[model samples]
Target: MAAEETGLRVQEALDRLTGTGAREAGEDLVRELMAFYGEGLAALVGAVAPEALVPALDRPAAAGLLVLHDLHPEDVGTRIVRALDSLPRTPPVLVGHDPDSGTLTLRRAESGGGCGCGGDDEREVENAIACHAPEVTAIVWEQAPALLQIGSRPPTAAEAR
Candidate 1:
């Protein structure tokens, strides 16, 4: 699991501990650990940051940490464009990037065959953006999602030959 997934799981466990006296202990432990490690991460960012951003973003762990702390040197729009360009399949056409709201709008490419999965592509894209460019708070699809058609219906009891 990624750092984000691990943190979410830990948070869920902590929430379950609430109303039990151990909750405070868990909370304090988390706070202290975060402070200790966050300080180290900040120092590391200051010390070894590459002059170019592509290097930092190319490393998954480093990219996640930079995004978690808002220390990435690239602007939100640039990151969004880069993330889209990295997609393996037909990439979404860039509609717009709103820095003020941190929302990215994308439309389906008109020339490609549709996956017909009803926005699974969008969700995957969103997840990817969250990993590589957490600055984007939301992704809005300007085009309607493609819908998959299931195979022909199975024969009923009376319809069987």
Candidate 2:
């Protein structure tokens, strides 16, 4: 099974167990741990000049970690541009963004030729967005690129009805 699928299953099981007064307690523990680690991360980040933090946040894993700790210094849009630029090939065109809803849409370039990316591309893109642009709650495809146009050339005006 995919790692994502396994993680989702574990989350579901955890949610089930939380129904018996365990949710609040579990949340308290997680909050305490997060507070502890987040403070340390914030201190380390704060020690460095703001400009110096870019290099550290540019790394995907590091970015995710800092974002989780709420220590990332960049805003969502900048992080998104950084994430999109990280993709191997030509990045898609961002069509629209709804800040209120955290919905972003992008259009695949036709030159991509129906990439072999499968579904992993979506998850990877989403994960990247979450790390840098957590405010973007969802990614939507504005258009799927076409490999070819089916219609032949249009006939001259004489054929018009």
Name the regions of candidate 2 deviating beyond 4 angstroms: 1-22, 115-118, 144-161
* Model 2: lDDT of residue 131: 67
RMSD of 1: 12.4
Model 1 spans > 4 angstroms off = 1-19, 115-118, 144-161
lDDT tens digits, residue span 1-161, model 1: 24665566567656657657576757765765565566667777688646855676857677777777777767777777767776767777888878788888888766556554546777778866887778678888786667799998999989996
Go through the candidates in order and give the clash count of each. 0, 0
Best by TM-score: 2
In candidate 1, list every pair of residues with a backbone clash: none
Q: What is the C-alpha local distance difference test score of each model?
A: 0.72, 0.73
Query: Candidate 2, overall lDDT?
Result: 0.73
